[model samples]
Target chain A: MIFSSALIETAVNEFARMPGIGKKTALRLVLHLLKQEPAQVQQFSEAIARMRQQIRFCKLCHNVSDEEICSICASHSRNKTLVCVVENIRDVMAIENTQQYNGVYHVLGGIISPIDGIGPDQLNIHSLVERVQQQEISEVIMALSPTIEGDTTIYYLSKKLQGVPGNPVKITTIARGIAFGGELEYADEMTLARSITNRLPLENYMQK
Target chain B: MIFSSALIETAVNEFARMPGIGKKTALRLVLHLLKQEPAQVQQFSEAIARMRQQIRFCKLCHNVSDEEICSICASHSRNKTLVCVVENIRDVMAIENTQQYNGVYHVLGGIISPIDGIGPDQLNIHSLVERVQQQEISEVIMALSPTIEGDTTIYYLSKKLQGVPGNPVKITTIARGIAFGGELEYADEMTLARSITNRLPLENYMQK
Candidate 1:
């Protein structure tokens, strides 16, 4: 859209650069910010700028953090021996929100997507391996998604862990199948197949 | 969600403050930015900051601009005697994109929405009326939305214009009702009624 002002055009363009934000939505967002107090807008700008400029990656698990070691890895209350390996910090958050697990996390940053030119080296795989070898971790849960990249990364990690002489870490994947409240008829073929293959014991299934 | 970093938390809070963005989408956007180079993030930051700081408003029509008078109002090719009144600069851009109108515009900052604490006094309504009285504009087209606030503003403006002794301006509203390629059955009752009542002559509608 041909705006009367170059400033509006520039601002809208910048906002539109964000993923999923189109021109119309960007214009709306920019206009919304324009209506706010100058100090508020300054705060918004600074928030983003400072976050990008000063944010650090946790040395242990590679999650985005402001410290050398993230709170999750540093906490004594959580089980450091059981690490939930995920694709990114966002997954760490999702798992934490459930409050079902008391284990720490290892954020891989991304999966090994061959088509996207991303491999194990591009992710935090090396560090994860080093952590498993150096630390006293007993189990490493491969909590990656059920995608080609996720499976490849898990396979590669398991192989590497087996090769490490002193790194006798137990590797397992999160259960995949029909979700809670999901009907058998609506389940995808792959999920249904996996659910049947990894069928739980009758007594355990009936208990819940 | 428990963010490992304060900077990420602050940035995500700012992003979530936007109209349509939720916590999840905000986190995704912040993570996307984190992947970008610091220089690129700085460009995004500067774009918004510079735009807000240097943006100017057209003195006569209150449209956003980089100067006192906007390009549309200052152009000699545009019809100086015809002015299209709109609700905001966004409407100005929408109309300009049509490439159908050659007239200048007067952008009222917003409509008179009392529930939202917005009144005619808060808008650029006074300047618009003054322009009609002082300038040689022969026609004023009300290109506003078909909403209650839009209709009220038009009513108020028409009454104010009629009181001006020497200002003999013809005021007209844009057509309303079913949109192009819209099914008659799907149209709301009020729109269908208005479309029938204000039906155009078959020749006028079909000629072009």
Candidate 2:
């Protein structure tokens, strides 16, 4: 009936709110914090607090950054003309970790899920279109998940950008290095391998 | 070669320092925070910071507390004479959750582990001795783990308290609700069942 200190309880409750943490795990984490040096806890709290305060969405690519433009978007060495569109900042990081692509990224924030009430307007699609038209973009790669919502967004984007005037930006998708209904986040190394190799040209679909 | 934003990378590295969390998990958590509303992140951070600033060890029992004394120690309804000596505050909470014991608790901070160079002095044994001498305590229940280190600590405390004069406190250990070499934290339901039921009287060893 009687609980531990309210402050400790509050912190434990917060941890329990996380995806996988339970009450016991939360208690263990809280107790560990109690055992840590005061300065360590201070640093932990400050780091979490400053995470948002110190970081922002990159104005151009929408990747998380401390400044107006993310490092990838600002870098001159990256192929700015080749823009890879992703669902979120995590996806951006995932592609970046692969080190296979030397292009910039555009975070869509989320896929177009009508059931979830997420439409094209809710995403950064307008900005992506604007970037293609305004910038010297030669290719726009869709590296989104292979989910139905992801496919819908890709189809919508391709339809909207079809036959645009200057240079005709090539709209492509990262070969489903992911399986049907599988998340890009959980794709295995080998599966990701075959997908990349079998990446079909987007131009072939346009001809049909 | 190129990392995520330096601030974000730094935050992820700090999160990775926690037990069981790796760089990938840390990045996931950091990105989760980045996606959250700034206010939510602020709340999460402030919760951790306030926890450390507002909570302190109970002066009387050495358990985490928001006030001078912990809830169990301050409650007038609980048995004041029956003291449960535990290895840590977590044990105190565990016993409290069972709602089986009405006795107060004395947190030892840790058990005696010579291998870890944790001797009797490193624990709160002196305070326990003083508590028994000063208070109208009748029973001292050793709820320490059933490990060799736990046994050594119980033996040492029993021997020390046996020399004290007036009101010879009866010392008993929680029936080894623990298996040999098993941590008290991971004991199963049936084992914990038999351990509590099989608690033995420490006075039997005193005569020897």
Candidate 3:
């Protein structure tokens, strides 16, 4: 059997590691890269390396950022009092593309999946609670997915944040902006059901 | 709305440049990278970069190669006299996986697509013809797809390779190892049918 160079095979294998790319698609992409100008390939490689070297999590929100704090967290014009909690950076981008929410975001890194060994301690939950307790944050909007792990994260976070002193922060989840068992990233921009429907009382949530 | 950092966004945009990867999928891939340890992300990026930097084209066969000539072309044990000319590296891999043809290969880089402004001169046709004229080659098996462009390429190469000196250069095609309108990459390995039904004569092709 004919075998491509190890370099080409390595790149193809990396592409195959992506969510949906198979070996054929990976080979196609690698071949396309090979056909491109060397400068363009260098740029592609540099971009990926730069992403890893330059990007970091926002200190306050745990969202991806170039600086210590993300643009949303750094922007003074944004409503710091209103924090929207999400599972990952993709959710942050999804919400950003809508240009609707004027509030900041808090990324949990992931949901509470016991089977996957993800729990509240493994997430950025402590910083989220600290942010609410330290700032004049009036509301915490849980914009997590509608999966069981998502629900478990929300329940765990709300209980933890309720014990914080002073104004005793108010926590609310996005009115089921998504359907049961639906992924937040796949939800149509306009068809999301939870933006308004699952709106629960923040005060009532604290009491519970 | 929330925004992912520009560095992260830049990486996503880079990935989005690949065929079939949209902004969403790019973001998904970037997030996956972000979650990985810094060393893993470094490896992923370096693998892609090194692919272009380290790989070279085989001088003889024009397939991607680590050294001067590809393994298939460099191996003295392979059928040196029989050359299977294909459109790209993927086709080389496809034929290799079949384990049927023990001959060497010549990658044409691409086919003649007039609509895409690609002509015979734009491909590696000249090198192929040069190899046939200079080497002790006997057969030139055209293993391109059955598309109009594939047909056009085969016709052009056949006309160019005619009357070359040495062992009466026989120009043949892959017959129909591929289905009508099917892609070479998608053809099932086991169900490949070109060994029998698809075999057509270059003389018959010339008559058309």
- The top-ranked prediction according to TM-score is 1
Residue-pair clashes per prediction, in order, are 0, 3, 9
Q: Which regions in candidate 1 have their CA more than 4 angstroms from the true location?
A: A196-208, B114-117, B185-203
Considering TM-score, which of the candidate structures 1 and 2 is the better prediction for this target? 1
Of candidates 2 and 1, the better by DockQ: 1
- Candidates, DockQ: 0.76, 0.53, 0.55
Q: Candidate 3: list runs displaced more than 4 Å.
A: A177-208, B113-115, B165-167, B177-208
Worst 10 residues of 3 chain B by lDDT: B190-199
Ranking by TM-score: 1, 2, 3
Candidate 3 C-alpha lDDT tens digits along B1-208: 2345777767778888988889878877877877677787788778877888888888998888899988888787899999999988888888889888889999898899999999888889888888988888888899988888898988888888885555568989865555557876787764465534556688975864
Q: Model 1: per-residue lDDT, tens digit, B2-63?
A: 78789999999999999999999999999999999999899899888877777778888888
Candidate 1 lDDT, tens digit per residue, A1-208? 8888888888899889989999999999999988888778888999999999998888888888888888877888988889899998889888888878898888888888889999778888888878888889999899999998789888998998887787477889999989999999989999999999999998988875
RMSD of 1: 2.5
List TM-score (chain A only) for every prediction: 0.93, 0.84, 0.81
Best candidate, DockQ-wise? 1
lDDT of the candidates, in the order given: 0.88, 0.83, 0.81
CAPRI verdict (incorrect, acceptable, medium, high) for model 2 = medium
**Model 1 residue B11 lDDT score:** 95
lDDT order of candidates, top first: 1, 2, 3
Worst 10 residues of 2 chain A by lDDT: A173-182
